[model samples]
Target: RLIQRAKRFWPAFVVAGLANALFGLLDAGFVMLLEPLVSKGLVGRDPETLARAPVFVIVIVALRGVAAFVSGYTMAWIGQKVVAEFRCQVFSKLLRLPAEFFDRESSGNLLAKITYNADKIARTSSSALTILLRESAFLISGLIYMLYTNWRLTLFFFISFPAIAAVVRVATRRFKKASHNMQDAMGTMTALGSESLQGYQTIRIFGAEAQAEENFKKTVERFRRKFMSMIATQNLSTPLIQLLAATGLALVLYVSLSELQSGRLTEGEFIAMVSLMMASLRPLKQLSSVNSQLSEGLVAAQSLFDILDEPEERDSGTVDLPTLSGEVVMENVTYCYGENSPALIDVSFSVKPGQLVAIVGPSGAGKSTLLNLLMRFYHPTKGRILLDGHDLESLTLSCIRRNMSLVSQTVTLFNDTIRNNVCFGLKEVPSDEKIIEVLKQAHAWHFVKELPGQLDAMVGEGGSNLSGGQRQRLAIARALLHNTPILLLDEATSALDTESERHIQAALDALMTDRTTFVVAHRLSTIQHADMILVLEGGRLVEQGTHQSLLAKGGVYSRLYRLQFGEPQLGTTTS
Candidate 1:
């Protein structure tokens, strides 16, 4: 995937590789120049050689510097661009992924993949590749020079090559394993830190600071241990490889010195050979170090690819309804999470246009599950849902969602101006007048007006600057601004005090006046005026009627209402 993304920058990479090769050639040329400068200028006392050599050396050095800069800059550019594209693809995939995927994965791990892993990939794709190529060129050119000067000595110098290869191969396997473990450990550390930071208030209120700190410390320690192992492998391999090179150097020196005493090798040739051998050692050491970085990059790339390959949410519906008539019906719908028992069992209900329907049930009685199915966050395990007399499966998901607005107990707000949060995702930006009107209708304009910049004030992360009731009211205002034909509320006012709830409820009454609204609330009194109410127990719909009618029937709804309101006297009317 990285290579595919880098296609547009291939020319740049090619130029970089050629430039690096040229740099290596210059290195070798410097070694070759030493022989002529020493023999002709110093030993032979040639004035012409002395005068020309300095200019030749200066020109070669200047060209090499330019090549080095171009090679480094181009490789860095390609690496950054490739990783940027990869990160974008990952983020886009996250947006398209099904809700179930998120349910099983941690946000911190996903974040690490986008940030930490991407940087590792950049190092591998650019810096590691540059070092590998440049060093390989240097080593190859140095060897060719050695062979030209003295093949017998060059052949002896390669005796340690096989042993060095064996050591590197073993070290490569260890480095890869360590890299994988470190990546996993880092993800765990990120998850621990994210959880603690996000829930710091809860920790403080509950006096669980020590527990949180301990958990975070454990995760960090694990990451540190893994990181140290990786460092050890990386540090050990370089010196070990260098030691093998040193052995080869010692043998070459021993042979060259003998040849020098026998008059078979000139002083200039001997020095040139030694200088080339020493120059090659640095590149050899760098190549060994790069193996660890390459391993880290490969591990990160694999993790990112796993996310990119995940299947996106299925959207098979072809019909695109321009508008919905606000009628909703569920027929024998059943759903189960995984292999667990069904969350909703043979449940069914219907609402006509402009009707107010309330769903009241105990925890785990499928109140929220019903809403999820309606929103198409999950498909029914059996039967189907219909909107405006058409199966919901027949209409595009976007069309179905666009016609409905949701206000839940937990509201999400970005760190942006209040206006943007209220008008979030709208095709056309809402005017100031329209924004204020919705806020007024939702009973939020009073507080919003008192804020520093009114509608333009920043809300801070997750609307942390606002009180819970204020945030809830802002969410309702957002929903009202959507002006969808259907409204779904999941305990929209449950988190507020009685006074706040009453004020917000009044605004909701107006908002629901002309829309089909489905509400799930635990507060029995809140739904007494609903046009129709459905009572659920243990995933089954036990009763359906107007609140007064259900009370007259003396079924599950009556028992629940009696429990909340206290048992009615035998002679007194339940209502």
Candidate 2:
């Protein structure tokens, strides 16, 4: 996948590498010229050659400098594009993932893949690989020149090969292991930091600031330790490589001295061979350390690819539904998250096209799960759900959702103007007059009109600048504008005062007049007027009836109602 993506930039990548290679070739080629220059220009004092020596030196340096500049600049540009493309892939994959994936993975860890892990690929593509390619080329070219100068002497250069390989093998393993640990710690740190920042107000109110700080410090410490481990491996390998190179040089020196005494090697030739040997050793040292960067990048790439490889939410249904009639039915529908116990069990019910159904339950009784199922966020583990007599799975997911509107307890608003937030996800936005009419219908236009920019007012991050009631009203305005046949209201009125709630409820009642509305009610009083109330307890539908009938039956619904309203006992003493 990486190769396929990078193929578009193949010309630039190759040019960058060729620039580096030219520098390496020139570097080795210069050492080869040292012998002839010293022998003819200096020793024999050849006039023309001596006079042009300065020009030759300048030209060689200039070419190498130009090559280095082009290689560095071009590689950097390619690195930016690579990072950008990978981040885009990660983000696009996220949009297609199933709700279950979000249930298991935190937003922070996912963001780390884009912000932290993707950068390692950039460093690998530009810098780490740069050293790997350039240094290898330099080492190969230098070795070739030495062999040409004195084949017998160059053979001794291999005396330390086995030792050098051993050091590199050990260091590579250490680097890879340490880098993996560091990345894991980095992800944890990012998750913890995001969690802390988002809930800082709650943490402070509960006097848990010290606890939060300690937890953050621990993650940061773990990240530091892992980073140090990678650094230690890199630091330790350098001296070991230098010592091996020196051993090889000592053996080569001994062979060279013998060859010189036997009159087989000239002084100029001997000097050139030693110069190439030193030049070769520097690149060899750089090559050894470059593995650390490569190992780190390898670990990051694997993490990113793991996300890319995950199958998107199953959309096997070929049905492309048009507008729905809002009729809904569930026949023994059950849902379980992974291997856990079912959150909804054998839940069977049916609602008319324009009926208001209230789902009342304790905190974990799967009240929200019903809405989640209707929204096709998850499919039933068993049984089936039907919309307008068509299987839920048969209808396209987007088409099924288009017929519904949701306003949850926590209203979601982007950092955009009021107009955009109200008309979000609509391919073609409604006109300003239409938006204003909807806002008034939601009882939100009063305050919206008072804002400086009115319709163009920025909501700030997650609508933080607005009060909870104002945010909820805006959400209602959005739902009102959508005019979906099915409306799901999950405690949307909780943030408002009694007067505001009454007004919003009146507007909502008008809106739900001919719509299939499901209210996941927290307050029994609010849903008392629902046509049918489904009372749930421990993931089972224990009772179903209207408020007056359920209260008369004296079941779970009656018990919950008496508890909330503190209904006076028929015959009992006060505390």
Give the candidate number with the greatest lDDT. 2
lDDT of each residue in 214-333, candidate 2, tens digit only? 999999999999999999999889878888888888888888898989988887788888888877778877887788988998889889999999999888777877798899999999
lDDT of each: 0.89, 0.90
RMSD of 2: 1.6
Clashing pairs in 2: none
What RMSD does each model have against the real structure? 2.5, 1.6
List pairs with backbone clashes in candidate 1. Answer: none
Q: Report model 1's TM-score to 2 decimal places.
A: 0.95
- Model 1: residues with Cα > 4 Å off, grouped in runs: 261-264, 566-575
lDDT per residue for candidate 1 within 274-383, as digits (tens), equals 88888878888899989999999999999999998999987889898888879999999999998889999998888999999999988889999899889898999998
Residue 273, candidate 1: alpha-carbon lDDT: 82
Instruction: Choose the strongest candidate by TM-score.
Output: 2
